[model samples]
Target: MSFMKKHLKTLTIALGCSAGAFYLGWQSPTLMGDVFEQQQVAQPTPRFYPLERFIISVPGKEYQHYVLLELALKSSSANAKHQLAEADPLVRNSLMKMFAGKQVDELNKPKNLEQLQQEAKDLLTNVLSANKFAVKIDDVLFTRLVIQ
Candidate 1:
């Protein structure tokens, strides 16, 4: 009882300080809205540019197959639309070449399709970089994919 009384003031001060720190920390985000606003303003809005439909010929063991692919390029660049417009031909050509010679059985699997999406993204990035286009592709989304 005596010891508790002796340290009572110190303990109260420590507890009060801790609680005050917690409250301030909890409220910091709301208080820092200006910083967040600046960050949001610095980031560009994501844009999607859809390319023309692609009709690719896939070779099989005994027969020829066709893949109809309609995809869009996602980017966060301000001028993505204009850059993509200028690089459209090269983009289509690269993707067509990549899709060519793919086996039907290979593209039929879901896992393979996901891999293809990543591959397409990388291919587009390369094509844009090589062509000196100021575009950075974030993803390649397939709006329509048909294997016939």
Candidate 2:
């Protein structure tokens, strides 16, 4: 009974501190969640810049073939469209060269088409980087694709 009386004050203080800590911890996630939501809201939306249509003849063993492609570049930059306009010729030439090398069979499969989209994105990013352009491409989207 004497020992309990001696430690009672210390135990009460410890319990009070623990309760306070638990209360703060319980509230922390709500505060942190609000901060995260605000950050997400502050982030810029992605912008897309469409390229002119491309009609290229593909060399074949027997008959002539062609591919019609329409592409759009996705970026977070506000000036992506203007920058792409400046680099349009080079972009078209690079894509044309890439498509020119593809056979009809290579472009026919759905799997191949997805691969081609990724390839185009990487290729455009490289082209923009090589030219020292300020624009960064996030993705390449094919708005239209026709092969015949």
Candidate 3:
């Protein structure tokens, strides 16, 4: 009882300090809205550029197979999106040429599909760069793929 009484002030001071620290920490972020606003201004919203549906003929052992692919390119600027749109003819032709000789069996596998997506992104990025489009394709997304 005597020891508790002796340390009560110290404990009270420690608790008060912790509570004050927590309150300041919680309030600091709200006080710094300008910092957050600057961050938001620095980062641009992402954009997606979709290619029209692709239907390509793939070589098969006994019969020809058709692949239907829905693809979108992701970038950080509208300029990239506009560039892709302007070069739609070249883009479609390049992708069609890439997909033309692929085997149906290869497209059927999940691993092959992933590889195909990466390869397509690389090819498209290269083609766009070669054509003097100042945009980088960050990713290639396949929303729908069918091999039949």
Candidate 4:
């Protein structure tokens, strides 16, 4: 009985101290100030830029033809833009090969345009893996994609 009484007193005192500390903390402006500071911190938006939509002419067994591709460039940071400096030919080559892999029907299907876009995004992710400034591809838009 005595032990229980002693332990109860100790526990009660500990809980009271804890509650008081928490209450004091809640009543202070420091937490709100910290939150305000956090909100004020500037964060950069993802840098997204236009990619050249080009028509690729590949000589095939049947005949020479043109394949159109629409592409967009994205980067997590602005440094990616500085690193890349300008438009790149390698990026175009990678995009062309990716477009060539798709069937003519797949490219022409308007319903699958989203799928094609996501595929292009994934392709960019893969191709830009080795770049100094990592780029996140937003989408591939084909302004004109006609193979003739």
* Segments in model 4 whose C-alpha atoms lie over 4 Å from true places: 1-27, 30-43, 57-65
Candidate 1, TM-score vs. the true structure? 0.72
What is the full ranking by lDDT, best candidate first?
1, 2, 3, 4
Worst 10 residues of 3 by lDDT: 32-41
| Model 1 lDDT per residue over 1-148, tens place | 8889879978999999999999988888797765544454467779888999999999988989999999999999888988899888899999999989578888878778789999999988988898799988999999998988
Q: Which segments of candidate 3 are over 4 A away from where they belong? A: 1-41
* TM-score against native, each model: 0.72, 0.71, 0.70, 0.60
Q: What lDDT would each prediction earn against the true structure?
A: 0.88, 0.87, 0.87, 0.67
**Residues 1-148 of candidate 3: C-alpha lDDT, one tens digit per residue:** 8899779978999999999999977887788665544454467678888888999999999999999999998888658867887888988999999999788888889978779889988998899889998888888899899989
Which ranges of candidate 1 are over 4 A from the true structure? 1-41
User: Model 4 Cα displacement at 90 (Å)?
Assistant: 2.5
Could you tell me the TM-score of candidate 2?
Answer: 0.71
> Positional deviation of 147 in candidate 4, in angstroms?
3.6
Compared with the true structure, what per-residue lDDT tens digits does model 4 show for residues 1-148?
9999999999999999999999878866675565434456576677666666787765555766677655556666656675444436667777778776665656657898878777776766676775543655555555556667
